[model samples]
Target: MVIADLLGVAKVAAITLNERGRISHWDDTATELFGVAPPRALGRPPAALLRLPREHRGAFEPGGFGHVWCGACTLPRVDDGEPAEVGWWVYPIGGTPGERGVSVLALAADLRRLRRDGIGITIGDLLLAPPDRPAGDAAPARRPAAARLLRVEPALTEPSGDGADTFAA
Candidate 1:
């Protein structure tokens, strides 16, 4: 299926930002996922709507690197409901950061759904799952320094059914 169709069914919401970081494209999945309408979602900084914390801004926010940024964050409920854990992937469009840097962001409201469907959302060595792979299969090992800070291991995200981590801390 095309990416648009994929986003619609994958429990993953995607948004696009214009050069100035203003909301540009908020897809149907995003509207339902965030509970925000186009009028409210557009022209606003994502941090304001997504409830990203200031302390972790460096990791969650896009930067000059143009690399895909992925992280796990608890998002505030739009209607004062229970918060939810959302996995986010932010990719910068331009080669360098500046006043004009468009980006496409994908947020996974249900990582397990993606994992169950055999997809691993990744950044550096953070997440290693590939599309449609069996969740029980072993993912590769490439430990990034950030992995330590994130306290992430393959087994932490994907259990081998025995409840033991493949790579122990």
Candidate 2:
């Protein structure tokens, strides 16, 4: 059965950034993903908290243009320095940074886990294509029917012996 028939990515962590590109909210998942708790992560710029790739160094900066930027990143855990491969999608909220400013929501997932689970996701799949503008404003890209569906293993669709018929991921 199709698990999801839409453009989306699995997110393992959620972080909210204020207009200044500083962490405003860090959820429990964020703590687990980055090993940085809210107490130490809040108010800190993403650059200071995570080691972004050279090309993506400006990922968290307010681009003045409100858009969704998604890709992969490798970051060392703040607590142990252990590296983690993370997939990310960053999008602005409220308005562009130049206008009234806005809060940005950043969602990340562990790539290793996604791969192990047989989820075929990629940056290109997430964006559909390199976005020319914010995901909401841009016209959806046209793609083959095969590309729109995510195939799920029978184990995920098969219900347990329990009375509830819920699909487990």
Candidate 3:
């Protein structure tokens, strides 16, 4: 069983697709996220499950590179409940030569809490992509509007060795 399946939570989902865009793995989290069980989603086109927009669907094609896209939007469900507004990230996921596949990793949290408190966590230098196209076709694809690169540094300061020092000096 995958990590999501073992956890049995609906907060995160993971899916892998091949050159043909067929589903390779669909864990429990994915089932809850998309509302489609593995038996039904497996072997099906990624578009069928996600129903991505036409322009965005092309980006999911296997082996296609040079762009990163993301959005903070809501996902609609047919069940008798309100739609879910989520923060999502999407990008190409392969580095092997001649390999063609894209992996989409998504994490969803309560929107209310986010709106009230903002993201309290500190994020380091992030490599954000420009909104416009790069100068030349050879130029690396621009980062998506929502993309942010965070550089995290470990907190290494320790308490002073002095007997009474309770904080780092």
Candidate 4:
């Protein structure tokens, strides 16, 4: 559905953030969802408008921002009514992080309706949080130092028609 929305097969609210993480483009759909027109939304960080949690606050930092998919997050409406749960995707464009002219495209959809449609969508669907640990403890299950430096690529080869798949790297 996210892919469909991005391809124009479906419609969703869209916002674009500049390299410095200030709003650059705000679409009508965005105004409908957030209840803030482009005049008030532009030139401001999303955190200043949305009720973003601490973890998601990094989305406004160019140094830490990356391609992120937030399956469900609550954002307060402009009228201060019940919060709206929505799913969003953030993707950088033009250049990589720290590069000039880089901008981010954010697409958001209402999760309540998504659930009503029996889509079975869940929060943190695409995000994998690091395992929690007790205080002052090293992370568990870390790869060996040597393994961290290793690079592996699958070898491409023609199928031999043996009714089995083969991969070598």
Candidate 5:
């Protein structure tokens, strides 16, 4: 199935942003969630459509596209009731840091739903989880290093009467 069809059925908004923060692919669910249809929003700067503040707009810099700039940004629902908190995932989409054609994918979730589901871990809590190392303090044994050079004597062409080949050092 096509990506557009997949996005439509998932009920999750999928937005693709260019290096300059312009909208590339604004899927169906994105239109429903943001109330800005593709016909009008495609190719336009995302900051303008979302009404992002100047300070926050810098988060879309090509190098910073996919890193989580703001874990949550509160905005009123389209119907205009209580504000909803939306988390953002920001990081560079295409190629390395300085390459062109970078894109950003923003996955937004309703904070209310998250709270109802008991998502309580803070960023610090997640980052500070116990380090994955053994608790024992025993030091490992070290093997002795071998000398790199080895000397060998030439073998004598004639064998000794004792039937042993003699080697001269």
Candidate 6:
């Protein structure tokens, strides 16, 4: 019930995949975003059915290097289909997505957004793809995976004329 409520309340499209890459949970926003209804979409491979690249398949595997994977991808131009340069993330945690075996929470965008705006690396970019370096240059050292997850509280305030004072960095 809690999982359904959270996914249902999400304003964006959210998809949860089973261990075999089949669609286990598809939110209402996903129906609107992908033009596919639930129950019908269940047990279907999202990559092949939706024409998405298979690079994200690594997100659901056990003993995976990371918990989050972000990348820019293009969705096929179906009947006036979704965004082209949309960014998505695979958040495979223990308790989130749906209750069952390991679930991979895949969030996709329908607009031309480059990346997730506010959901930055509160957990640090541990297994993220390393940045590009010039020729002959050694790769930068990876940061220690010691930064704890940061919890943020969204606050709303009336216009105080002093803009930018409402949010804390």
Best by TM-score: 2
* Candidates sorted by TM-score, best first: 2, 4, 1, 6, 3, 5
CA lDDT of every candidate: 0.56, 0.66, 0.48, 0.59, 0.50, 0.54
TM, every model: 0.52, 0.58, 0.49, 0.57, 0.48, 0.50
Superior candidate under TM-score, 1 versus 4: 4
Q: Per-residue lDDT of 1-169 in model 2, one digit per residue for the tens?
A: 1344334334357787888889887888789888888999988888887877767756677655457789997878889989988988888775454333447878887777667543333233343432223445544444433333233444655566786535324
- Estimate the Cα RMSD of every predicted model relative to the unseen true structure: 12.8, 15.2, 15.8, 15.6, 22.1, 15.9
Q: What residue pairs clash in candidate 5, if any at all?
A: 65-90, 65-91, 66-90, 66-91, 66-92, 67-90, 67-91
What does candidate 5 score on TM? Answer: 0.48
For candidate 6, report its TM-score. Answer: 0.50
Best by lDDT: 2
Lowest-lDDT window of 10 residues in candidate 5? Answer: 1-10
Give lDDT tens digits, candidate 6, residues 2-66.
11111101134678777666788887767766667887678886765576667755664433535
lDDT of 1 at 109: 52
Predicted candidate 1 versus true structure: per-residue lDDT over 60-167, tens digit per residue: 344534566777767665756556666777666654533444554544455545555743344444345445556586665443332222223343355567865444
Which tens-of-lDDT digit does each residue in 1-169 have in candidate 5? 1111111011235566776668777776566556667888888876766755466676655554345565667655443434656656555565642333546766555555545443221121121111221446233322212111112223424546796534422
On a 0 to 100 scale, what is the lDDT of residue 68 in model 5? 56
Considering lDDT, where higher is better, how would the candidates rank from best to worst?
Answer: 2, 4, 1, 6, 5, 3
Residue-level lDDT tens digits of model 3 in 43-96: 777677665546656555555643555665555542434465555555556554
> Which is the winner by TM-score between candidate 3 and candidate 4?
4
| Candidate 4 displacement at residue 91 in angstroms | 0.9
Q: List model 4 lDDT by residue over 1-169, tens digit each.
A: 1221111112357788777888887887678777788999988989987877777777655556665655568878765556888778777664563343447777877666545542221111221112233446543333212111112222334654785545421
How displaced is residue 6 in candidate 3, in Å?
23
Question: Which residue runs of candidate 5 sit more than 4 Å off their true CA positions?
Answer: 1-11, 64-70, 76-82, 94-102, 116-169
Weakest lDDT window of 10 consecutive positions for candidate 2: 122-131
